[model samples]
Target: MSDTGTPRMKRPSLHEEIVAEVRRMIVDGELAPGEWIAEMQLCGDLGISRTPLREALKVLASEELVLLEQNRGTRVAPITFDAMLAQFEFMEALQMFAGRLAAERASEDELERLNAMHREMIRLHETGDRSAYFSLNQEVHTLIASAARNPPLFSVHEASAGKIRRARYQANLSYDRWAESLQEHGEFVAALTARDGQRAGELLSDHLRRTGIAVCSALKAFEDAGERAPDDRKGRAR
Candidate 1:
C-alpha cells in the first residue's frame, strides 16, 4: 500500500503502558486508597527503571489517581465518603443528560450493540464474575455516552468516569446492590430501546443517586468497623 493509503500504527509507549497498569492497579484495588506507593517495590515488580515509572506517575497524578508528595512519598488517592458523593452527584447530571440524548439520537445498530453487551453482562453476573461484569458495565455506560452524539459532553463524562471508576466497581461489591443495579440497567435499557428520553434520563439519574448513597453507607460501615483508618475519613485527597 502507498504511504498515504497505509495507516501508521504506533504501539503503546513504555510510559503509557506503565500509566495504564498503575491506574488499573489503583482502580482494581490492588493498591488501596490512602496506601503508600513504594517506588522501589513498584519498579522491581514492573521490571522498569524509575524514569519511566516516575513519568507514568506524573500522568496518573494529573488524573487524580495518585498523590505525589514531596517527602512523604506517593500514595493512591483516598476516596473519602464526601468526595464519592460529590463525584456521583456530578456524574448523575452527566449520565442523565447523556441518557436523554442517547434515547433520542442513538441509531438502531447502537441499541443492538448495547443489548448484546447487556446480555453478556447478565451472563457474567450470573456466573459470579464480578470483574468481567464490571468491565462490561463500564462499556455499556460508555456506549450510551457516545450515542448521545455530543463530543464535548462525552469527553467530560469520560474524564469524570475515570475518576469514579473504583467507586462504581465498589458499588457492586455487595450482592444485593449488584442485583439491584442489574435490574436498574434492565429498566434503563428498556427505556432507551423504547426511545423514552425522559424516562431514560430519570432512571439514569436515580441510579447514580442510589449508587452514591450505597457507596457512602458502605464507607461509613467500614469506618465504624475500623476497617478504614479514622484519618482517611477526615477529608478527600486533592
Candidate 2:
C-alpha cells in the first residue's frame, strides 16, 4: 500500500486538527463576528478533504463557536458586549456555587492542586506573558471546578466558560487589572483551603463579575479606536 512508490502515511485525525485551527482563527479575531464560513474554502485553505472538514464544522457548531444552516452554510456566532454582561451575571453565580461546593468537598490533594495552580498563575502574571497567563487562567477555573467533585456542575461550568474565551482575553488589556485578578485568585484558593464556603464564593463571584467589566471596557476602548463591531441589535441575542 504505497503511494508514489513510498510507504503510505498515517496522519492525526484531520477533523480535530481542522477544528483546533479554525477555533484558533476564531479566537484570534481572524474570523470576525458574524462572518460566514464556506466549507469549500475552508477545505481548500486547510488542504483537507471535504469529509473531515464537515466533521470539524459540526464539532465547532456544537461548541457554539459557529452556527450552521442547512442551505447557507456556517458563520461565526456574533459577539456582543451586552452578552458579555449577561454572561458575567450567570458565570458569577455559577463559579461562586462551584467554589462553595469545592470548599465542602475538595480532598486535601485537590486543594493542594488548586493552590499550586494559583501560584503558577501568579508566576505567569509576573512574567508579563499575556499568552501564558491566558492558559493559566483556564487552568485555574478548571482546577476549582474539578475540585468541586460534581460532574454535572463541572460540565456546565466548562461549557459556559468555553463560550467566553474571547471575552476573557479581551479583558486583559490593562496591566493593573490582570494583577488584581491574580490577587483575587490567590485569595480564592486561600479561602478554599480554609474550607470557608462563604468567603470562597464571594471571591469567585467578584472575580467573574470584574472580568465581565474588564471585557466591556476593552470593547469600548476598541470602538473608540475606530474599530467598529456590529451594534449587537442585529447580532445574536445572547
Candidate 3:
C-alpha cells in the first residue's frame, strides 16, 4: 500500500477485460453480427489465453451479445430489423415510464445532473464528436431512469438498454438523423425541466420510436448498397 493509501484498488480481472473488449468490438461492428467468433484470433489480438477468452464469451453469451453452441462453437448474435424494432418497443415503454417518473420525483440535484449531461451531449454534437455524444446521450437516459427512485424499474430499464445498444449505435450514423435526434433530446430536457410528466413521457416515447425508424432506415440503406451482415449467410446455424 502507498503511504497515504487505505487500500490499493483491485484491477479488472483478465476475463473481465476480455469481455469488455469483445463487447466493444461487437458494438463497433469490428466483430459483425453472425460472424464466427474465432477464439484463437481474439486470443492472439488481445494477448490472452484461451481460458479467459472462453470465460469472457460465457459472460457475453449471457448478455445475448453472442451465441454458444455445442457443435458450432460461438457466433455473434444475428441482427434483424424486426428484432431491432421489438427491442426498441420495450425500450420506448421503459424510457417513457422513466421520464414520467423522473419528472415527478427527481430531486433538484438529479435534475441538475441531467441538465449537465445534456449540455455535454450538445457540446459534443456541435463539435461533430458522434461517439462521445452518443456516450453521453446514454448516460442522460440512465440518469433519468435512476432519478425515478424505483430500484425495480431501473433494473428492468438497464437490461433492455443493453439488448438494444448496438442498433441504437447504428441509428446515429446518418448526420441528418443525428441532428434531428439532438433536437428531440433538447425537447425532452425542456419538458423535464418544466416538471411536465405527461409531456416528458410523450416526448420520450416519440423520441425512441423515431430512433427505431432511423435504425431501420440505416439497415435498409446498407441492404440497398449490397453490404450484407454476417447474419444473411444461409444454411448456417444462428
- lDDT, each prediction: 0.81, 0.76, 0.78
Model 2 clash pairs? Answer: none
**Comparing 2 and 3 on lDDT, the stronger one:** 3
Residue 78's lDDT in candidate 3: 69
Question: Which window of ten consecutive residues has the lowest lDDT sum in model 3?
Answer: 229-238
Native-referenced Cα lDDT, model 2: 0.76
RMSD of 2: 8.1
lDDT of 3 by residue, 1-238 (tens): 8689778889998777788889888865678777898999889999988988999999899988899988989998866777777888887888788889999999998888878888887788777776677667778888889988899999888766765666654443457777788889889888998999989998998988887777766666666776753322111100
lDDT of 1 by residue, 82-160 (tens): 8787888998999899999999999999999988888987897788777677777888899999999999999898877
On a 0 to 1 TM-score scale, where does candidate 1 land against the true structure?
Answer: 0.84
Q: Stretches of candidate 1 above 4 Å error?
A: 1-11, 168-172, 229-238
lDDT by residue (110-154, candidate 2, tens digit) is 888888877777777766666766776777788889888899989
C-alpha TM-scores of all predictions: 0.84, 0.77, 0.80
Candidate 2: count the clashes. 0
Model 3 reaches what TM-score against the true structure? Answer: 0.80
Error of 2 at 102 (Å): 1.0
